[model samples]
Each structure stands twice: as structure tokens, then as C-alpha cells.
Target: MGISKPSRRGFQICCGVTVILLIILATVFTILAFTVFKPKEPEITVYPQGLENITFGFEGFLNATANATIAMIVGINNRNYGSFKFKNTTGFINYRGDVVAEVPIQQSFVPARGKVNISTYANFMVDRLISNTTFWADVLAGSVNFTSVTTVRGKATVFKILKLHASVPSICDISIFIKSQSIETSCKTKLKL
Candidate 1:
């Protein structure tokens, strides 16, 4: 008796149908990967920063423990089609190589394709700002430059459903001309998951 080849296949999906199914699955997977797993970066810009209510220290050391409130203007742009919900965010202000001030970004939800502005402020000591040799030299030279950095650690929701977690770092360079009361700002952002 010969094994009747076991009817190689009873009922099977047609080759064309199988190919179509495979294509559909592949397309769906690709879309999901790009939208759910891919990391998206939001754009950030720091407007001009101003030194307000600045007061130098007491008698002997004027620059020591200077009391001053610094105000920094920040703008965030969410370009993704999904909303970004950030929490426990923080901002850092650095002069030369040292962090002169820090602030916490209020927990909020950034809508998709939306922009939001924030005015961040922190009290920093001129003693710390002048601590950096470069900053000190610049101060003596009459030109001061600082950096404003804002970081948002949160999850991105695509189509209001898929949530992927990541951290977004936004940095801006600040040039302050104390003599002229002029300020210049430029910014850049990076996304890291």
C-alpha cells in the first residue's frame, strides 16, 4: 500500500491571498513600530532671560551670597501627532560649568501639535555665578553668558492610546549684556529614550 501523499494540502489559502495577508500584517506592524516604539523629539526655545531684583552681598564681600531672582522664558513645541504627558520635570540654569539655579517644571499635558510657554524663575547667588573662572573672567570683561536647560521626563501617547516613555532635553544659550540691558537667546532640543 502506498501513502497517498496525504493530500499534500486539503484546503489552503491561495498564494495570492497569503501574499496579501503578509503585506497587510507587515504594513500594520511597521506603522505601529514607528508610532509606538519610535522616539519623537519636541522642539524647545528659551526666550531672553532677565536678572531681576539683583542685590549684592553685605559689606566686605559684595559678590558673596548675592541675592537675585532670574527669570527665564521657555517655549515648548510638540510636533508629534500624539500628546505628550510630562511629569516631575525640571529645569536647570548653568553659568560657565556650574548650575546656578534650578526649577521644577509643573506637571502638564502637552497636546499634539501644540505649543506652550512658561516663565521659569529661580533665585541664584552671584557668588555662585562668579565662581566659574570663565564666568568671572567674562564678568570682568563685561560680557556674561549662561545656559538654560529644561528636561521633561514623561510618556508620549499616540492616538491617545499607546504610551511610550522618554526624556526630552531642551537647551538654550543665553547671552546677557548687563551694561546694555540686552539679552540674546538660542535653543536646541534632543530626544532620548
Candidate 2:
């Protein structure tokens, strides 16, 4: 009787549909698992070291500068990322270190942690007049106390420039002001030295 054709048409159609549905379901589940169960990559956040203040003897500065400079000390709290083009670090000093003006350190260096005490002329303002008045005010007032200046990045020693020569007081009298906040800080340290 033609073996009744065994209802090949209906059975074949059902089998085809089942196979297709299984494939679709598998694809969907694979996509979901990849998106949801995959592990995420780790991220790192480097907390910058705080150089709050500094105080170095004039003799040390003289040796560091390699040139005759005023007798003064200086300090600062800043982020000297690296020996970049003087635009990344955010520290300041009363004395005219290597950087005459406020600059930013734009480079990266090793030892992503700890302090440095290298001496450089990048923060010296050079020979200038020393005044009795607070130097920060003059800086805030926009007085050009120096022709050029450089901001230095040192190791363990932080030089603080409090006052210039008390004798003539016209060689290099200066003061500095700085304020920077940390990652979790609400109030910043406003220093005057």
C-alpha cells in the first residue's frame, strides 16, 4: 500500500523546525553568557604622594643650583608626575626655584611612589630684589619678581623659601602660597611660607 508513506512529510517538517529552534536557542544563550558571565578586567588608581612642605639650607641649594643664588629655603606640596614640560606637577614654592611661573609636569617616571630630593635649577627665580612685605601677596598681585623661574622636583629634602637677605633685603625677598586637595579631601591646605 506504498507503506502509507510513513507520514514522511509531517515528520520531516517537525524535525527540521526542532533543529532550527535548538540552534537559535543555543546562539541566544551563548551571547547572554558571554556578556553576563565573563570576568571584568581590573583597574588601578594611584594615589599621589603629598609633599606638603619643605625646608632646606642655602648651602644645599647652592650646590643644587650650580650657580650663586640667594640664601633662602622653600617647601611645597605638589604632584610632580615626571620630568615633563613643566605642566603636570601641581606644587609651588616661595623661592624662585627652577620654574619661575606656575607650570605643569607633563611626563611620567618610575617609583610611582615615594619622595625625591634631586636638586635642579628648574625652580629658581634667579637673583632678585628682597622685600619685607609678604612675597605671596606680591605674587598674587601679579608682580614679576623674576625674569624666569623653575619649579624643582627633589627627593627627601624640600626647600622652603621664607625670607630673603635681611642685610640688603634687595637681593631676593619672597614668600609662597599653595593649596591642593587630595582624592578624598574636602578642605585643601592653604600654606604661606
Candidate 3:
């Protein structure tokens, strides 16, 4: 049997309508991706609470040692249209450019346009702070300064299709007052996508 002319015409019309509809949908999605669904850098804040179990004295004849626990809270604010999922990472606490403590960060996730706060405790210990000549001067001044550095590695997934790898680096400068047993902190962060 041979196909009729009217049926062939109807089939061609249906295919043409489908192609036009697909083109329109593609254009709409492309526009939205470039405008509404664009990615942005997340904001980070660091708050240092105080020092716990702080003890500093001479271990032996002319040997000085120190031990304490640093309590801090870290906040992550996600402003993007996607969720950020990060892996486990380690943070460093530096005194005069020397690493003196390690902070361990567990893997976690931050929802889109949401915020999360992480509470961390890092043990601060140094066997020979007296070896550094400036250590005594800093103690006599009643306050000591330290720097904290951390990097979070993650992937942001938008609409379950677009995946962007991101690295967020945070740096915090902290000052601890010995007499008042107080802490002050300032932090800055950078995002790499």
C-alpha cells in the first residue's frame, strides 16, 4: 500500500511544531542559566570564644611550656542557587608563622541560600615557646596574636545538572588577652570556582 498525500502533510506539520517548541524551551533555559542561576561566593565568619584549661609556666630550669584549648565558631553563608557539599579538611593555627595547633573539620553540606555554623575546639600546645625570643615580650604585653588558615573543598550542584568545583579559603587573625581571658577575632575569605 502507498501512503496518502494528506497523511504525509499532517505528519510534516506535527514534526515542525515539535522542533519549534524545543527551540523555544532551549532558549529560555539558556537565558535563565546566565542570569538567574549564576553562582556567587559564599560568606564566612569566624568567632573565637576563649581559651580553656590555659596553663603556662616553666617546665624545668629555664624551659617554658604552654597548653590550652581554643574554642571557636565558624559560620558559612551560602548565597548561591546550588547546595555546597564539602569534604573533611584540616585547619592550622600559627603563632609568628609557626604552626602550633591543628583544627579538624568534618565533612558537611550547606543548603542553597542558607547558613550553617560549626563549633570547633583545637588544642593549643607548645613545648618550647620560650625558644622564640619574642614570646616573652608578647606575654609581658598581656596579649598574644595568632593566625588561623583553613580551606574547604567542595562541589556545588545546580538543578542536579550543573556541577561546579569550588575552593573556599579562610584566614582569621585572633588575639587572646591573658589578664581578662578574652578573645578577639577578624576573618577574611576567598572563593575559587
Candidate 4:
């Protein structure tokens, strides 16, 4: 078929417009894919805990039989634009390089750009610690020092595009004064989420 000059020009124009529109759509899709698939980790903070609220009881005045219960609180800050689904969190209280108490975290969910408070209890017996020499020395000094390690496991989900898993650990020092019924604590938590 013999083509007219104006018809040929119109066909060229339509081809050029279609090619430009296709390139624009491809670029927009690429940008959106990168933005939606980026990964981020959640953050956790353990409050400086003074164990004053921890209850201590002894079965025998001179015996090594002691029972204790502790209340611990922590704050989780979710900075990402997603929800965090935390798994079973646990905290271990260590004294003289031994675990004295085990705490289970109560709360589980952290919303996007939100903060949450989690409370846990550690109740344990001192049967193994009674016969220890350093334990009595620390008790006689009227102050006993302890360490707590907490671990949190979770996954962050965003817009059905990204899901990143994270593990967070925290450490804190605890001191209890027998005579004053008081407690002092220092916490340094570097979350590697």
C-alpha cells in the first residue's frame, strides 16, 4: 500500500508517545519496588530497675532457704513504619555467674511508630545459693549485686512487602541493700536489631 506523508507522520508520532510512556511506567515501578522492600529493625529499652519492689522472703533465719519474686518492666520503641510481632521473650537474672531467676515477658505486639511497656515476673528459690561462700559474704556486707540479661525475638512486617527478623539483647546491673530495704541499678542496653 502506498502511504501518504501525513499518515506516515501520525504513525511516527504514535510510536514515539508509546515508547516514552512505557519507559516512564517502568521507572516508576522500579522506584516503588525498592521503597517497599527495604528492611528495618525495632528498638528496645530496659528501664533502670531498682529492685525495691522485689519481694524477698526467707524460710529459715540462719538457713540458706530463701524465696524471691521480682517485677521487671521494659519499653519497646518501634521506629519503623510496620508492626512488630515479638516472640516469647525471656530474661535471666545472674548472681555470682549463676542464673537465679527467669522472667517471661507479658506483652507481645508493638505498633508502627509506637511504644509499648512490657512487665514480667521472676520468681525463684535460693536453694543452690545457700551453701555458697561468696553469697554469705555479699549478704553480710548488707548489699548484694546481680546482673540481668534479656533477649527479645521478633519479626517486622510492612505493607506485605518486607518482613525482617530481629534479635535484641540487653544487660543491666542490680544491687540490693538489706539494711535499708532499697535497691540500685544501672543498665546499658545496646540493641543489635
Top-scoring candidate (TM-score): 1
lDDT, each prediction: 0.75, 0.32, 0.84, 0.72
Residue lDDT tens for model 1, 1-193: 6435444342243566788999999999899878764556777777646667887666674525676787766678887777787887777788867888776667778888899887776667667776666876786677788787877888887777777897787888878786787778787888766
TM-score winner, 2 or 4: 4
True lDDT of residue 8, candidate 2: 80
Q: Which 10 consecutive positions of candidate 2 have the poorest summed lDDT?
A: 162-171
Which candidate gets the maximum lDDT versus the true structure? 3
**Which is the better candidate, 2 or 4, if ranked by lDDT?**
4
Write down the RMSD of candidate 3 (Cα, Å). 4.0
lDDT of 3 by residue, 35-121 (tens): 887667688777777666787788689877787787878889998889899999989988898888888888889998899998887
- The alpha-carbon lDDT assigned to residue 152 of candidate 1 equals 81
Measured against the true structure, the TM-scores of the candidates, in listed sequence, are 0.75, 0.22, 0.71, 0.61
Total backbone collisions for each predicted model: 0, 44, 0, 0
Model 4 scores a C-alpha lDDT of 0.72
lDDT of 3: 0.84
